[model samples]
Target chain A: MDNNSKLTNLHMDAIREVGNIGTGNAATALSRLLGRTVDMDVPVAEFVPIYDVAAHYGSPETYVCAVLVRTEEEFSCSLIFMIEEEKAAILADLIIPMDISGMDEETRLQIRDSALSEQGNIILGAFLNALSQITGWVLPTTTPAVARDMLGSIMDLVASMFGVIGESAMLVKTSLHIKGLDDELGGTVIMIPDPGSLEALLSKLGVL
Target chain B: MTQPIHVGMADLVVSKHPATLVTLGLGSCIGLVIYDQASKTAGMVHIMLPDSREAKNLPKPGKFADTAVPLLLEELAKLGVNKSQLRAKMAGGAQMFSMPGKADSAIFGVGSRNVEATTKLLAASGIRLVASDTGGSKGRSVEFSTETMKFIVKTLGTGTKEL
Candidate 1:
C-alpha cells in the first residue's frame, strides 16, 4: 500500500481509539444520570462520504433525538448523541419518573423532551471530556443544540458545516444500551472531525 | 406516473411541472431554484461554496455559486426558458454552530456566505429573487414544484412551510 494509504489507516485507527475512550466515559455518565448501568458495543470510526453518514446508523428518515455539540479548535470537530424518539420518550420517563395521565400536552412534552435534551448534553459532554484528557487538546464545544428530527436533516447540517474543510467526514461512532433495559431502547453516538484536523490528529497519533 | 428528480449534495437538475425537484438536508449550503413560469421550465442547483476560485477551478460547476448559477441558467436556456421570464427562490443557509466571542470569524460563516453569494449571482444573472427561506440555526429539506412555483421548506421544530 502507498504511504498515504497506510497513514490514513493509522488515522482511522486513532479515531477508533478515541471512540472507545469517549464512549466509555459517556456510558459511565449515562449510568450515573439514569441511576442504571450503561454499556456499549465496540466503537467504530472511519472516514465516510458526506452522504453516507445517515445510513451508517439506520434509515435516513429515522426520527431521532439528538444533542449536537460543535467543537472549536485548530482541529475542530462535532459530536452528536442520538436515540430514537420513542426510546428517548422512554428515557424521559426514567429521568422524570412521573405519570403523564393528568398532565396537559404542553407540560407533558416539556418534561419528557427536556429530559432527553439534558441527556444528550450529559452524554456528549462526557465524551468530550474523555477526548480532551487523552489528546491533551483543549477542545471547546458549542452549546448543545437539541433536536427531535429526521436523521437525514441533522446529518446534512453536519456535512455542510464540516464541508468547509472537505467533502468526506471522519466519524468516530459507538452504540449504547442501558443495562437491564431492552437493547432496542439504546442509540448511537457519532463524532465528525474537521478535515483540517486530520493531519494534526494523525501526526499526534504518530505512526501507531 | 411521475417521480421527483432528486438532487444530492453538490449536484443540480432541471425539470418541468407535475414533476417535482427536491434536495434533502441543506445546512450551510444553498439550494438555488429558478424557473421561467411562462415556459414552465425549472432548475435547481445544490451549491456548497460561494466562489469557484475556492474550489481551485475544478470542473464541478454545480458545487459553487459563481459557477453553478451561470451553468444552471445555460441549461435552462437550452430547455427554452426565456432569460427575462426566470425568477428565483432559495433555501438552506443555516449556520449550524455558534462561535464563542468571535461572531465575525469566517470559520463558521459558510451559511451566511452561501446565502450572500446566491443572492448576488441571481441578481447579476438578471433573475429576480422572489422568495427565500434562509439563515438561522436549523437545517431544511427543500422541494420546488414547477407547477405552482412553490418552494416548500421542511424543518424539524417549525413544521413545513411554503414560500
Candidate 2:
C-alpha cells in the first residue's frame, strides 16, 4: 500500500481504539463521583471527512461544552459536547447537588462553575491520555468552556480559536450513553494537522 | 371584569375571571395553554423538550411536555372547569437548528418532532386544537387572551398577529 493510504488506516484504527479507552476512563471517573456502578457505552465510532462529519450532526441550536487540548508537538484535539439546556441543568444538578437551604447566590454560581469544569476536565483528560497512549504523543489540555444556551455561539468560538484549516481534515465521533442518566452524550473530537506536524507524527508512528 | 394574566416559562398562574395567559420564545419546543371560558380559568406550559424520560426520577415533573400538559389539565379540573369546554390554542415549534444537508426534509427535525408529539398527546387526551400557529423556521412569542379566547403569535421582526 502507498504511504498515504497506510497512514489513513493507521490513524483510523488509532482513533477507534482510543475512543473506547477514553470512554471507559470517563465511566470510571463518573462512577467514582456518583458512588455507583456507572455504565458507559460507546455506540458509534467513525472517521469521516471533516466536512461530512460536521454536516452529519446538523447545526441545531444547542448548548455546548468545548475544550481544546494541545500535545507536546503542538497537535491539538478539540472536544465538543452538544446538549440541550434542560439536560444541561439536570446534568449540573447531578454533578453537584445543591442543598438549596442556606445557599447564597455566589455559592450557587461557584457550584455551577466547578461542576461544569470538573465534568469537562475528567472527560477531556481521559480522552487526551488515551490518544497519547495510542500514538505515543503527550498533549497538554486547557480548561473547557461550558456554554449554557447556544450551539452556534460555541462553534463560532471554535472557528476563531483554530482559525481556518486548508482542506478536509480528520474527524472522530463517538456516541456515548451514561447508564444512570439514561441519556446519550455525543462527543466529537477533531484533529487538524499542520503539514509538518502531520508528516512528523506519521513518520514517528512508522506509517510514513 | 378582570385583568389579563401573563405567565412565563416555569410559571403557573390562574384566574377565575376574564384574563389572558401568555408566554414567549418557543424554539424547538412546545407551549401549551389550557383555558376554560366559563370559569375564566387558564394555564400555560412552555416545555423546552419533548419528554422527561431521560430524567425520569428527577423532581419537578412539570417541565416536560408529556408531564406538564396533564398536570395543567388536572389543575384546570380542580378549578371547576370541564375538560370538554376547555379550549386550547397553541403556537411555537420553530426549527431554530438545522442539520446541514437535511434542511428540506425535517425527518430528524427536533422542532417538528416536538410539534408532532404535542399534537398526538393532546389528541389522546381528547383536547381539541381549536387554533394553532406552529412548525415554522422563525421563533414565536405567543399570548393567550382568556377574555376573548384569542391566541396571538408574535415574531421578533414582525408585529403581533392573532391566530
Candidate 3:
C-alpha cells in the first residue's frame, strides 16, 4: 500500500471519530436549551481543499455567528453556526417570544440583542464544551461576534484570524435538528493542521 | 412629476425624471447604476450574486451581477440614454466575513468576491465608478439622488455619508 493512501485513510478515521463525539455533545446541549427531545444526526466529515469547500456546500446565502475557545492545552477550536437569515430570526423568536403586533423599536432592539448575543452565548458555549470533552481538551471561552445578512463579510473576518487553510485541510459538516423548533441548523468546523500535527495526532490515536 | 425608484435585492428599476434610486439592507450584495446626466435618465440594479453561471436557466437574469449590469445598460440605451455619457456609482459590499475558528474558510469570504465581480463587470461595460463605499462589517442603505447626481450611503451603527 502507498504511504499517501495510508495517510488518507488515517485522517478520515480521525475526522469521523471526532465528528461523532462532537455531534453527540451538540445534541445534548440543544435538547436542554429547547426543553425537548432533540434528535441530531451523526456529522458527515470530509477533508477537502479550502478553495473547493464553497462549491461543495451549494452556496446558499448564509448567516453566521462564530467564536473561538482555547483549551488549557494551548489548542483552539472555532465554533460557528450557519443559518439562513429568516431561519435565524425564527430561532431568535423561539428563544425569546416577542409581541409582534405593535411592538415598539426598543422592544425590537431587545429581541435583536437577545437573539444575537444571548443565543450566541448559549449555542456556542455548549458546542465548544461538548467539543472539548469529546477531544479531552479544556477550551477557554471567548466573546463571540454576531453577524447578520452577509456570509462573505463574516467569512473574511474568520479567514484573517485562522489564515487560509491549505488544500489538504478537512471541513467537518454537522446538522442539528431541535425538536419543537421545526428547523435545522447546520454547522461546519474546519480542521486546519500545520506540518505534522495531523499525522502526529493520528499516530498517537493508533489510527495511522 | 418624478418619484424615486428604489431597487431592492434581485430587482431593477428606472426613471427618466431625476428619480431617486434607493437600496436598503445591503450586506455583501451590490447596488449598481447607469445614469445619463444629459437625458436625465437613470437605472439601478440590486444584484445579490456575482455571476449568472450558477443561475443557469433561472427566471430572473437580473439577479446576478454579470447579467444584470448589461441588461440595465441595454434597457437604458433603448430609452435613448447614451452609453458615452453614462456615469456609475456603487455601494454595499461589506466584509460580512465570520471570525476565524467559527466559519468554513471556503464560503465565508464572498463579500470581497462580490465587490471584485461588480467592479469588473462595470468596468467592462465602460462605466467608470465615480464613487464607491464598500468592504466593511456593517450593512448599508444606498440612495442615488438624481437631483444632484449625488450618492448617499447610510450605514448601520454609523452615520450617513454623501459622495
Candidate 4:
C-alpha cells in the first residue's frame, strides 16, 4: 500500500478530473433516460482498502445492487456501480420496464435486479465511452452483470485482482445528486485500477 | 451476554467457552476456524492470500494462508489447547466475480488457492479439516461458537448453513 500512497493531492486532482469528465457523460445519459436533470459531485480519487470499501456506504453485509464491470484491454481496471438495496429498488421502480408495485416481494426483487443491470450498462458504458475519448485508448467496456448480494460477497469475488496487485485500491468515488427529486437517490461509481494501469494513467495525465 | 469477537481482514482472534468468534466478509479471503473440544476454545483467522512468498512487503501472517495457519495454531497452543486435539473447520475463499473472457480460468484463482494452501498447511500441522464449504462465486460471513464448535457460513441471499 506504500506504493499506493504516492499519489499526492495534485495527482489525485488530476485523476479526479478524468473521473469528472467520464461520470459527467454518465450523468447526462442518466438524465436523458430518467427525463430529469441529474448532477454529479467532483470525484475524489484515493487509495482504499478492499475490505472496508463497502463500509463507506454502510455495513459489509448491507444488501446492495451492484454492477461489476472490468476491462483488461488498454490497461486493466474494475469499476463498480453500487446502490443500497432500497435506493436501488427506488431507481428500479422508475427505470424497470415492468410494473413492480403490484408484484409480490420476490417478483419485485427480480424486476429490480434486471432493471439495475441494464442501468449499469447504460451509465457505466457512457463513462467508458467518454474515458476512451480522453485517454485516446479504445477501452472496450466489459459486460456488465448485476448481483443483488452483500457488498462483501461481491468484493470477495473480485479481491484477487487487488490481492495480486496491491492491497489498496485506486478508488475513484463519484456521487450522483438528484436534489429535491431524491436527495439520496444517486449512486457511486468506484473504479479500482491495477497498479500498472494507475501508473500509466497518472503518467499520461502528467501527474507522475 | 457474551459478544462475538470480530476478526477483520488479515487478522485473527481466539475465544473461550460461551464466546463467539466471527469474521465479516470472506470474499476471496478465508476464515480458518480451529477448535478444541476439551478446552471449549475456538480461534479464527481471516486470511487474504495463499502464500507469504507472494507478498513483497513486511509479512503479516494473517494476510496469507501459508503463514496464518501455523501462527494461529501456535496462538491456540499457548492458550493451553494441545495442537493434537485441534480440529479445523474453514470457510470463505469464494470468488465473488469473474473476468470477461477469463471466466474459465479466473485470474490468480485466489479462492481455491487459499483453500489449497490452508489444507496443505493444516495437514502438515496434523490437524484434520472436519468440515468446510468453500470455492464458489459468493462471499461468505462466518461465525464459530466455542460451545458447540460449530462453524456457521452466511451468504448474501442464501441465508445461513452450518459447516
Best by DockQ: 4
- Complex DockQ per candidate: 0.35, 0.02, 0.09, 0.55
Docking class of 1: acceptable
Minimum summed lDDT over a 10-residue window in model 4 chain A is located at: A157-166
- Over B1-163, each residue of candidate 3 has an lDDT whose tens digit, in order, gives 2556657446788777658898765666677777988888888887666666743254555567888888899889888988889998888667563455634333444566677888998888889788888877786777886677778887644688987
Query: What's candidate 1's DockQ score?
Result: 0.35
Error of 4 at B78 (Å): 1.6
Candidate 1 structure quality by residue, lDDT tens digits, B96-124: 55545644456467778889989998898
Candidate 1 chain A, poorest ten consecutive residues by summed lDDT = A1-10
Best by TM-score: 4
Candidates in order, interface RMSD in Å: 3.3, 14.2, 9.3, 2.6
TM-score of chain A of each: 0.88, 0.69, 0.72, 0.88
User: How would you encode candidate 2's per-residue C-alpha lDDT over A21-58 as one tens digit per residue?
Assistant: 76666667655765656554452343333222323455
Native contacts kept, each candidate: 0.28, 0.00, 0.10, 0.52
Better of 2 and 4 by DockQ: 4
Tens-digit lDDT track for model 3 on A1-208? 1123455655776766766676666667766766767666666655543222333543323444433232223344455665556566566666675555477867765566456556656665676576566555566765655666434434333322222222233445676665654566444433333323455446545677
TM-score: which is higher, 2 or 3? 3
Q: Residue B112 lDDT in model 3?
A: 66
Per-prediction TM-score: 0.86, 0.45, 0.53, 0.91
Q: Which 10-residue span in candidate 3 chain A carries the lowest summed lDDT?
A: A159-168
